[model samples]
Target: MKILLATDGSSHAQAAESLLTSLPVPSDSELCLVAVVEAPTWQSDVASEHAALREELAGYRREVEERLEREVERLKSRFGRVSGVVLSGNVVEQICQLATDRQADLIVAGARGGSKIRRWLLGGTSDRLARHAPCDVLVVRPRDDSAEPARGLKRVLVAIDGSASSRGAVERLASLPLGEECEVIVFQVLAVVRSFRMDIVEQSGDLWEAERRQAHDDLNWAADRLRPVTPHVRTVLHEAEYVADEILTVAEEHRADLIVVGHQGRSRVSQFLLGSVSSAVLRHAESSVWVVRTEDADVS
Candidate 1:
């Protein structure tokens, strides 16, 4: 497998590196560690300040390159192949382009980076990359202080909604080289729209029952598909008004190390017009989140 590890030299990035090391990827898998250096803008045109700016940029470039090389060397000791690259451009666009050029199977990144203000003003790199990347994206959140120390990728929680995108997520999970010890919990959240009137409840009882049965069928189908990948598999059906909240609650209850969900494959314009559920989970989930995009989606 080919994997792209995007870094910004922050503590969060280091945590992502640690998470990657814990995964059970093939020995022949290749890892590329990339760092993006955004172009800087100056507010003044003073000659001395311009020279100072140039010197500062050059020093920063050197520091970043050195740090990237060290990281590559460290990964090389574990994996059979590892490489590092330093690029300049828009951070999100450059990372996506690199992933496309390499035909990477997965892209891994830290959920938060060095610049809090920039991330707040512009959406974080992990969020944008997950929305736009050509392949799957794994966003690693920082370790929670209250939770116990996790040994590795043991428990995984996947949310399914009976969409093609959801099926694609299951297929991706099955294709991964997770070890035998890994346990997978396939969960489906059934949204119940309630009416306050007693007459409406009586009229919709049959429809509600049918919907519940369909949800159970879908959950069982997903579980069956995952059985070949790992022996330890289970299914859960949750009914809630809010799907994302229910997913997070189940993940916490399971003590999951990873949460996998499908991207709705909404275009940039439509995504802005209609909000995304995957984006909400990506932003709020405490566990590492993997947003899988279908192959038919336009990755550009």
Candidate 2:
């Protein structure tokens, strides 16, 4: 796997590094550690002052480079075939560009950062990468101080909604090497679209039946997709009005260590107002979430 790890020298980014150290990647896998020096937008009338700007930016760029070097050494001690890069630009843009330039298979990153309000108001770099990268993306949340491994996904939960995006997550789960002893839980949450109260009451029973059948069929399809990986797996069906709420509820009820989810890219404008579900999951879930974005999105 060609993995790209985006670090900002924050504790959140360090958390991501810790998770990468434990991932069961192949020994031959290549890793890229990246840090970006953001350019300030002040002093815009510098058409003739390019040299001055470069000189001013040089110090910050050097700092970012040094941090990248230190992180590279830390990762190298734990993983194989690692390299580092330091770039000057907007953080999210540089991340996408690097991922594309290197043809990374995955981009891994932290959920929250030192700038929590900025990230929450304007989706963080990790959230942006998940939406726009050209490879699979993994957003790792900081572990709860009280939560221990507890057998490592002995009861893995796969959230499905029968969409192409959800199918992508299911296929990814099936491809992973969950040892024979680990049990897989194929979970599908039936999303109930809200409408007029009369309409909801009129079709509640019929909608429930249809959703039940669809969940069964979806679980079967997901299981078959994983047939190449694990032959023994169980499927669970859940129904809830709100997608995020139900997912957290199920995770808490089952004490799920890892929640696998699919990401459908949302534009920056919409993300600014209503945050994406994946982003919400990262903030709210008690357990870690393994977000599976598009093939084009990197797993940072």
* lDDT scores in order: 0.79, 0.69
Q: Pick the candidate with the highest lDDT.
A: 1
Residue-pair clashes per candidate? 0, 19
Write candidate 2's Cα lDDT for 22-86 as tens digits: 65566678999887777665566676586777776786677778878877877776667889988
Model 1 over residues 54-130: C-alpha lDDT tens digits? 78767777888999999998899768799999997788899999999999988988877773213421156778888
Off by over 4 Å in 2: 43-57, 77-80, 115-122, 145-155, 180-183, 197-207, 224-233, 265-276, 295-300
Q: Which ten residues in a row have the lowest lDDT in candidate 1?
A: 265-274
